[model samples]
Target: MIDWLNSTALTAFGVATTWAEVLGFGTGLLNVGLLVRQHILNWPLGILNVLLLMVVFGAAGLYADMGLQVVYVILGCYGWWAWLHGGADRASLAVRATTGAEWLALAAAGVLLTGGLWLFLDRLTGSTVPLADALTTALSLLATYGQTRKLLENWWLRIAADVIYIPLYGYKGLWLTAILYVAFLTLCVLGLRAWRRAVLA
Candidate 1:
């Protein structure tokens, strides 16, 4: 099963695209599309996407990103529950802007997480892109957390991470994943606009 997943699905533009990356890409598209529509099914698809990409990133020696997938699984589950019952009196979550305090907290967390993960990856792992990996991982965590809570700023965080991830994945030779991030960046922008409209409505 693992072998099949890692096997090349296709070669395009001189890059061999793996089945895992293909499936992850499909699921990622669905996940973000659903999220943009405020649909509840995005979480399960996102979990599957992360699981597939965990294999892809691990193969690319992107240790921090591989580990980020593991964290994403946990956050995905929490997000699933949060979307269902994380609102006032356990209602479905509604989109909202982040509070000033939440912004401060997320900023502090991003800095600390990026620094710690960078140190660990740089000193303890064979990762070549430790700083970029750690930075994206930290931003992704904050974005996923904010997303779970239906915070509007999550899209901005994701946009930032996706921009960085494009070049990082390309440099790692994961061209398919890099392209997926490009699409994700677009989706994040759409998500941001849609959620802002939701907030206003």
Candidate 2:
């Protein structure tokens, strides 16, 4: 399965798109689409999506992104359980706005993690776009953590990360993954609107 996933799925626009990238693209779309609807299934599908993307990013030498996927898998697991039980009296989760303190903490953590990952990737790995990779990776973790908590601001963080990710994936020749991020950006917008309505209700 690993070998097959690493093999070429198709040649599009002269780029040999891997099976991992193609499947990752599909799962990523489904994951976010479900997320927009506040569905629990998004967690499992998101886990699958990141697992596939780990292979794709590994091949592309985006080591930071590759490592990010591993963390995403752990976050995905926590998100799955949280959505099912992390509410008042251990009920289902509900959408809510982030607290000001939470926002400040997330911002501080994002900066610190980005700087730390940037240095590690730049000095310890062969990552060519270490800063951008680290930035997006940090933003993605913040977004995913917010999502797990049913925070509306998660969509904003996702929008920020996807904007950087689209170009980064494209530069790495992962055309399908780049396109996936474009779709992700659109989903993030929809998610923001939907979650806002949920909070207002």
* TM-score for each of the candidates: 0.99, 0.99
* Candidate 2 lDDT over residue span 5-82, tens digit each: 999999976899999999998999999999999999999999999999999998999998888899999999999999
On a 0 to 1 TM-score scale, where does candidate 1 land against the true structure? 0.99
Write model 1 residue lDDT over 77-148, tens digit each, in one string.
999999999899999999999999999999999999999999999999999988999999999999999999
lDDT of 1: 0.94
Candidate 1, residue 160: the lDDT equals 95
Off by over 4 Å in 2: none
Candidate 2 TM-score to native: 0.99
